[model samples]
Target: MSVLRINVILFGIGNIGSALINQVLESQQFFREKRNIDLRFPIITNSTLAFFEKEGVKNAWEANFDQLAIPFTIEGIIEFAQNKGLENVIAVDATASSELVKHYIPLIQNGFNIVAVNQNANVLHIDFYKEIRRNLKKFDKTFLYETNIEAGIPVLKLISDLYYSGEKITKIRGVFSDSLSYVFNRFSSEDVPFSKILNDAEKRGLLKKDFRDELSGVEVAKKLLVLARELGKNTEFLDIKISSLFYDDLEGTNLKSKFYFDADILDKYLEIAKITQVKNEVLRYVGEISIADEKLEVKLISEPITSAIGQLKGSETVFEIYTESHGNVPIIVHGDSSRKKTTTIARGILTDILKVAEKIKIKETVWL
Candidate 1:
């Protein structure tokens, strides 16, 4: 059996990052034996430091990172690849940092495909989004970031297929955030304070370090924008009307320094839950995209406990795709990505890598 070597340069050695590395390393034998592919991680980076080795990491990447990783920059990473004559390079961005997004164009230009687990690059200004796609085409590189929407769900590909197949998709709607799903599900069912659920979600790593980040609804809105764009809509992220669960309520909370734990602020959610309960409805944070009109929204909405969106439990995310053919019965794609978020995300990343690898294999066969 012949083996095809593909190099992976990983960024962000945080939770998801570490999980992906372990998954890749552990599954090496399986990939090699079954798929005839060898994935090599020549570089693994945190925000500032990186572990670089030509032969790729082994079972001791953690120790290697701790003992041998050195400070590095994006330029240094690019130069390292260029000097090493690396090909079939896939750059994995597992960071939540917006600053790291600026390097994506450079990496693509320097012969690197992208597999981003972050939303920053995909939900940037419309011009930059177009530019990135344009660069991908011009450079003949693939960019896949299915983890941005819902890691275990195939909604992105579903939307893309429906759009390309000439389906008249009128709307795409559902609970898009696992964190928000977990937050709202508990708030609606439990009589406990909303802060308790929020605090618990934060501890479980379902939320950003700052709980308000997920509650702002921007993350979910960005996800909506991503899907809309995938379905051929030119909607900008700013155009989406985000019905925030937290940002507007706080007196002095911006994104950077937002960590409000006031009892008064959390009371509104409790009140909403109680008031909605009288009507036999529960609250859910959801995103909806109307392709016929190109309108997008992310907000806290009320649904019957029996309804699909409302029935979502603890960190479950669902996506419903509406089309002319489907009529009353929309295609529902649901997942519980938050149950094992990091592992699911790691699987998603590997799936994307295989997509690229499959393409390379096809190209090689055609050439031969």
Candidate 2:
């Protein structure tokens, strides 16, 4: 049996990216011996610097990347892959940069499979999204973005599977952001103020560098748009009506230093919580999309503790799927949504990489 060598070109060396590298290295021998495949990373990069080795980067490449990696552009990296005539290449995008995402189509044009952890590229305009799918079909390439919707859970795959099986998805609803989940879950269970809970989540590195991205409900809206678009709804980000948990003017304020200074700003949530408590309900930030009505929304709602959305604990994300087959009962997909530690998200990326590899192997066998 001949071993297949799948070259990986990774973008971003942050938590998830670094964890993916270590994971690939850790599983290198196991995959080689058992699966008859060699997973090799020829390029690893951050925002400013990149490490490249045509012969495949060794385990100690991190030290070399730190000491000798050079500056690189998107074009430069693609040209290097072109010059090397790399085959069975998989482009792994772990960055959140919109600029990096712009290179996805070009990468596909060059015969590279894609596994993206970032959601920005997938939630583009409907035309661009269609173009991406068209390009993937035109080039005979695979693009897997299982980690985009929720970090670890296979929500996208579940939807795709259901759709392919002729099950019509009538409505998709869930809590998308684990950061907001932790905030609201704690706010309801504990006696802490909403502002204090938000501060604690920031301190725990649950929120993004820009705290507004999480609290503003924009990120959850993007996830909902991606899900809606995947369900064959021709919807864009603007289509989703997001009811943010924070005040509108909180964007320009110095949230980093004065996060706890303005406790009264979060009083609205506390007031709602108190009212909900009286009604025997819990507060949760929920994302919902009605496929039949062509509606999408992400908002904070109050529900009984026994409800699917209210039973969530910590930063776990829960997706309730309503289909023609399962009307009142929903197919629930629930798990931790926190990407700070990188275990689940990294595993999701690795699963995508392996899936691509398996496809390549099957194609090779068919060719033989």
Candidate 3:
């Protein structure tokens, strides 16, 4: 029997990666039999090294790590992918690093499809985003990052599909940052120290140690930029007005720092919400895009709310998309909602892509 094959390159092997790898292995037969697709994770990488197997990586690639060896580096990964004649390759950036973004431009330009869980690349300078998009257009490759904002949420896919289907979106808003939502909701009732909460969360693997990306609202802003781009608007990161709750000194620092929020700030906000009789009110960091009379407004809304934002449990994300056709669509997508979730999302996106490709191929063959 002839086998259908799809090549996969993975950039991280942490918790999410492990979960994803397990899922892929468990679902391998289902994919082949049900979807008529055979997916293979040929390359697994980390910051320092990578493991490549042309015969297809075993599900236990990391086991007995001493004997099975491969040098891990960005250059090595790129070289291996090119050498393997791996067309329609799926690059999973589970590393959550901005450095991987540069590799994407070249990969996309070379006809590689990428499914990333990394939000850093999308949040970078507008020029970088544009360059990647241009390369994607030039090579006709797919760059799927639906996991960036909300894992397994289909947020980006929904937005892109709606826009392409001629549906007009008037506003975009939701609980964008799981970390911030977690922290705020946890401390809404008490005068807990921000530093302590960050430490506890990180130690528990609930939040990234580098909390700036989540606290500075840059992550939320980046997701908004992606949505805007999908909506046919030319937007940059700076275009979004983020009302960051943390001070500038907190920027780029790990969560282990001794930074604490002003008790007064927390107290005042809490008191106001209480006096206003808002039940379950908690501070939620939001980025919004609204269109009124053909004029678009893109800004961040830092408000105390009683909705999903304030009520987000654990690391789940709930977002709402309002369109002319769909009206109000509420999407609730959950995962580890940590670094682990990001990696899983990347894997899920890759699996989804292979399934989609299989369907397309089947349709084309039938038509022919």
User: Which candidate number would show the highest lDDT if scored against the true structure?
Assistant: 2
Candidate 3 lDDT over residue span 1-368, tens digit each: 34567777877887767667777888889988887677787777777676677454344667623346566666666777788777547777777776777788877766567777777767677777778888877876767777776675567777777788887887777767666667655656566655566667888766776666666666677778777777877777767777665544444444334344443453454446444644445655566777554233323333445555555666566666676665665443333454565455646666556744664466457866
Among residues 3 or more apart in sequence or in different chains, the pairs in candidate 1 whose N, CA or C atoms overlap within 3 Å are none
| Higher-scoring candidate on lDDT, 1 or 2 | 2
Higher-scoring candidate on TM-score, 1 or 2: 2
What is the alpha-carbon lDDT of model 2 when measured against the actual structure? 0.84
In candidate 2, where is summed lDDT lowest over 10 consecutive residues? Answer: 250-259
Which portions of model 3 miss their true places by more than 4 Å?
Answer: 54-59, 64-66, 72-79, 189-200, 247-256, 260-282, 293-314, 324-347, 359-368
Model 1, 251-293: lDDT tens per residue? 3545424444455565665576568564778878789988767
* Residue pairs in clash, model 3: 49-72, 50-72
Ranking by lDDT: 2, 1, 3
Deviation of model 2 at 127, angstroms = 1.3
TM-score of each: 0.92, 0.94, 0.79
Candidate 2 C-alpha lDDT tens digits along 189-273: 8877777777678788887666766777888888888888787888888888988766644545685445455557667646665
How much is the lDDT of residue 220 in candidate 1?
A: 81
Predicted candidate 1, C-alpha RMSD: 2.4
**Candidate lDDT values, in order:** 0.83, 0.84, 0.66
